[model samples]
Structures are given as C-alpha cells and as structure tokens.
Target: MKLRTLLIAALLAMPAAVTHAAEPIEGNWKTASGATAAIAKCGGGFCITLKTGKHAGKRIGQMNGAGTDYSGSITDPETDKTYSGSGTVTGSSLRMKGCVLAVLCKSQTWTRL
Candidate 1:
C-alpha cells in the first residue's frame, strides 16, 4: 500500500513539472545580430539580458504574458533607445519586434540556443 501511495504521489507531481517546462521563452536565444540573449522570469514578468557579443551583460527587455505571445519594451544598447516591443514564440524560434509610435517597426527572428 505504501508503494502504491508513493507511485500515486509521484504521478501527481508530473503535471506540475510539465507545466513549468512548458514556458517556451525561458531559455537562451541566438539573436539576429549574432548575439546571445537569455530570457528568464523576473518579478511579475520576464527579463531579457544579453549574454554574449558587444552588449554582453545588458538587460535589454522586459515582457509580460503567457503562452506564445508577450508585450513589453526593448532597448537598443548601442543607442540607449527604448521602443515598444512584442515577442511571439513559435517552436524553437522567437520573432521579436520593436516599434516607434507603433508606426515604424522592425523585427528580428531569434533562434533557440
């Protein structure tokens, strides 16, 4: 009976583990500019930090949302400019966009690392 209870407890914990693993955006990415970035949970949202290249160690973005889409802001480390941004995750790729006044926008596709 104890063995059966242990097995049931382990089974009950599986879904929670799967749910945590389902966050597709929480990982390292290879940016379009040949840089590496890391996205991880920070506070109530997620933070994007540069892990490699010229802008290494810079915190460049913050996003909030669930599932495949997120909205937030992105910063250009070279110019120190911030733009309204959004990100969409599709499989091992993420399409990130930044806009000025929602009119002029630029996007880049970053691949998972």
Candidate 2:
C-alpha cells in the first residue's frame, strides 16, 4: 500500500515537474511599426521574428535572459541596421530600446498580442 501511495503521489506531481512555464517575453507582440512579431525560444535564447508587413518572416531580434528583463540585438528591417537593444516587460507591454554607440538611443512600446 505504501508503494502504491508513493506511485500515486509521483503521478500527481508529474505535471508540475514536466510542464514548463513560458517566460514573460514569450509571445506575439505588436511592434511600433505596426507589425506583428513573435518571440519564442530558440537555442540558448529567444528569437524575435516578424510575422506581418513587408518584413514578414524576418528574424529581427535576439534576446537572452528570463522574466522581465532581456538584452540583445535588434535590427531595423527598413534600414537593415542592427543595434544594441534591451527590453523590459511590464504587464502586457514590452518596451524595447535600441542604441547607437550607447549614446543615441530610441525606444518603442510593443503591445502583447
């Protein structure tokens, strides 16, 4: 009976152990340019790929870290220029900033979709 109880307890805990919770940065977002971008797990980090507009199917960003903060590179699909970028996730919004030389920086708030 003890062995059976242990097996039952383990079975009950299996879902909690095997299920992976998504990070705050994982989701589809509406970019400042009005394009839909999908952020998902890729290798060691997250890959941001555009899903709409002229830049559809383009991978424009990569970020590392979990929870509400991330750092990586972001590319401007219009200009094809890459910049150092960081992101902050708050509620349903993600504020993304890109910089040139770490002095000139621009930011945009993306809404989760």
Candidate 3:
C-alpha cells in the first residue's frame, strides 16, 4: 500500500513540476560574432548578456515571450541605441532583428555555443 501511495504521489507531482519549469533558452548561448552570452530567467521574461569577446560584460538584449519566438529590445552599446527587436530560436540557432527609424534595420543569426 505504501509503494502504491508513493507512486501515485510521484505521478501527481509531475505536472506541477513541469508547469514551473524553465524555458529552453534558459542557458548559455553564443552569438554569430563569436561572442558568448548567457540567457537566464528574469521575472516573466529572459535576460541575455554578453559574457565574452568585444561586447564582453554587456547586456545585448532582453526578450519577452515563450517557446522559440520572442519580442524585445536590442541595445547597441557602441551607439547607445536601443531598437525594437524580435527573434526566433530554431534548434541551436537564433535569428534576431533590430531596427531604428522603422526602415533602417539590421539582423543576424547567432549559433548556440
């Protein structure tokens, strides 16, 4: 009876565990320019920062969304400009776009490192 109770308890707890689980992007990743960054949970969103390379110790962006699609802002530390950015993550790949003045924009594909 004890064994059956334990099994049932474990099964029932699985859903709750999954519901509070972290997103797939909650880990370290690398950008196309060979810059490394870490993505971690920040409230209802994710905070991404450059961990090494020329953009070292800088936060390049913060994304708000779920699954593989996210919308947020990308900041250029050099220009001190922040743009409306959107990105999609496919497998180990991430494609991001940032724009200023609506028409002037740039995009890059970052690989997971």
Candidate 4:
C-alpha cells in the first residue's frame, strides 16, 4: 500500500514539475540591431524585456504559448504599436519577426548573451 501511495504522489507531482520547466528561449540575447533583451517566464507564458537600447526597461514582447517555436504579439516602443510576433531559437541564435497590419514586417537574428 505504501509503494502504491508513493507512485500516486509522484504521478501527481509530475505535471507541476513540467509546468515550471524553462523554455528554450529563456535568457538574455542581443539583437542584430544591438539591443539586449531578457526572455523569461511572465504572465503565465513568456515575456521579453528590453534591457538595452532605446527600448530599455520595457517588456516589448510576450509569448503566451509554449514550445521551441513561440508565437504571440510584441509592442514597438518607437511607435507604441503592437503586432504579431513569433520567434524560434536554434542553438545560441534566436530568429524573431514581427508583422504590422499583416502586410509590413521586420525580422532579426539575435545572439544569446
């Protein structure tokens, strides 16, 4: 009975452990444009905080979903506009893109710092 109880407790704890697992993109990275951003868990998902450049001290983007590839929206501090955003991390490189009005867009490759 004790062995069975232990197995049940382990099973119950598994989901919580997985829930707090870190995303592959979690860390500080430097964008091609020389901006530094820190990506980490936020708002039940992930948020990117601009740690350098013009947007410093801002949460410029957020990814509410999980996976190696993340999709969400980001804000442009320059224009105070929000747009569709997505990112994929490959090794120490992060490819990020954001689209404005579903027509105009921009992309950049960021290096892990």
Best by TM-score: 1
Candidate 2 lDDT over 1-113, as tens digits, reads 99999999999998997678899999999999899999999999999999999989999999998889999999999999999999999999999999999999999999999
- Residue range 31-107, candidate 1, lDDT tens digits: 99999999999999999999999999999999999899999999988999999999999999999999999999999
* Better TM-score candidate (1, 4): 1
What tens digits encode model 4's per-residue C-alpha lDDT throughout 1-113? Answer: 99999999999999999998778889999977688999999878888999999889988889865566998998877888889999988889989889977788898899999
Q: Which sections of candidate 1 miss by over 4 Å? A: 1-3
In model 2, which runs have C-alpha deviations exceeding 4 angstroms? 1-11, 14-19
RMSD vs true structure, all candidates: 1.6, 3.0, 1.9, 3.9
What's the lDDT for candidate 1?
Answer: 0.95
Best by lDDT: 2
TM-score per candidate, chains pooled: 0.91, 0.86, 0.84, 0.75
Q: Please provide the root mean square deviation of candidate 3 (C-alpha atoms, Å).
A: 1.9
| Candidate structures ordered by lDDT, highest first | 2, 1, 4, 3
lDDT of 2 at 104: 100
What is the C-alpha local distance difference test score of each model? Answer: 0.95, 0.96, 0.84, 0.88
Clashes of 4: 0
